[model samples]
Target: MTDAMTLDSYLAAGGVLTNPTNVPPRYRAELMKLMATFVDSELAGAAGFADVINQGPGIKERIAAAKIVLEKTDHADRVLKIMGEFGADTDRYATHHPWTARLDRKADIGATRSEHDMRLAVFNYPISGWTDAVVMNLLMSRAVAEQLAEFSTVSYQPLAEAFRQIAPIEAHHGELALEGAVKLVENGASQDMQDAVDYWWPRVAVSFGRDDPNRFEHLRSLGLRHSTNAALRERWARSADEALKQLGLKSPS
Candidate 1:
């Protein structure tokens, strides 16, 4: 904020950089990676869900599913435009990979990513059916909410502002998923719903990634991250468990 402030000191003192030109080279690289990861995950998530709109049990369910697909893709676009400010080939980046492509349902790749994209590891697995899709959406939405909460506070003003505007919309997607799950339970799929929860919990948990203190410190110095991965994962666990309990569904072991 002061005229003589260095970027590091400014960020450490809670200053925000409003433009791409204001960012240093290393900060720019990390910010690009962060944006790319989010964009890839959103595109992949939307693509996976696009296939399930017809699998919805009713018109309302189908409408919710379609809206989610639309909004998530929109969210990706908003961030990708930011990436474009850094000279990334936005057109090529969008079409560079098959976003809809997924691994076999039984793939056990853990948090390892496929060769071509940076979508979270959890997205690599295919959605099995309506129930499975609902569960994945609900759980992943909570994780996304936590991530957005953190991202919304980073030192990059424009990207942080983008996430701030995005957090509420993403939260609504989680709410829609929760509502859909409750409908499934009321319609006599409670047990089946629990099974879906069990299937997705671990995969979603791993998407939080492993904690590396060194890496966290490095990123923190750049003002790109405030909390460690372990902390965020634990926070999401509690949030997910509480959400599951309200629906009378037990959290996975």
Candidate 2:
């Protein structure tokens, strides 16, 4: 056994290892793939706000509303750092991986995301914030939080640290997002909340991850995934349902 501990070794130890060094090839690949996806996904997501705050009809409240997107992108960067420490090839992840922002730009109807301006977009796609998109993401992020909270217990020191850092901030995100939900009800999405809920319900149920058997072994053996995708997804559905009720919303009949 090498005296130095790498990202893989640390995680694979199941709390038995602690140190940061070189990452194993396969584990590195997985982490890099995961992080790259995350980085791109978040940046893509952030671009949505710029679309809203910049070109759309302006709202005074937008100044603060815009901040959420910025914080989310910053979150992407923080996570990227965790990815980088694991020997992620930033050049590759940056250049090759498609960011979520690009996904927002897709012409496909299902691919289309929500915008702040309701007129230019669908109101209840469960994606456009100006319409009814914000609630869905808020629900999904909250769901992911449950998994991340457990990830904080990863045997890897830095990975554990990363989750710890992100988890606390999520509390505020949940609050602000719920606040957005409240604003959404008052502003317009009140009637559409049901639509948002209905559309988001099935999607969240299936968005967990691949069902491959071997996938869990790698992560669990490595102590990286303390929570399964199914577990988190189930939690998400419950929270989303509860939150919808609290906001005086319901899934479409």
Q: Rate the local accuracy (lDDT) of all candidates.
A: 0.90, 0.58
Q: What is the lDDT of residue 18 in candidate 1?
A: 86
lDDT of 2 by residue, 49-114 (tens): 555554223463465457767776787778777776665565554445333322232233432333
lDDT of 2 at 192: 74
lDDT of 1: 0.90
Candidate 1 clashing pairs, residues 3+ apart or interchain: none
Lowest summed lDDT across 10 adjacent residues in model 2 is found at 117-126
The numbered model that scores best in TM-score is: 1
Q: 1-77, model 1: which lDDT tens digit per residue?
A: 75334777877777788888778888898999899899999999999999999999999999999999999999999
Give stretches of model 2 more than 4 Å off.
Answer: 1-13, 16-22, 54-60, 86-126, 251-253
lDDT of 1 at 153: 90
> Which residue pairs in candidate 2 collide?
11-222, 40-100, 44-100, 44-101, 114-128, 127-133, 128-133
True-vs-predicted CA distance for residue 244, candidate 2, Å: 0.5
Index of the highest-lDDT prediction: 1
Clashes of 1: 0
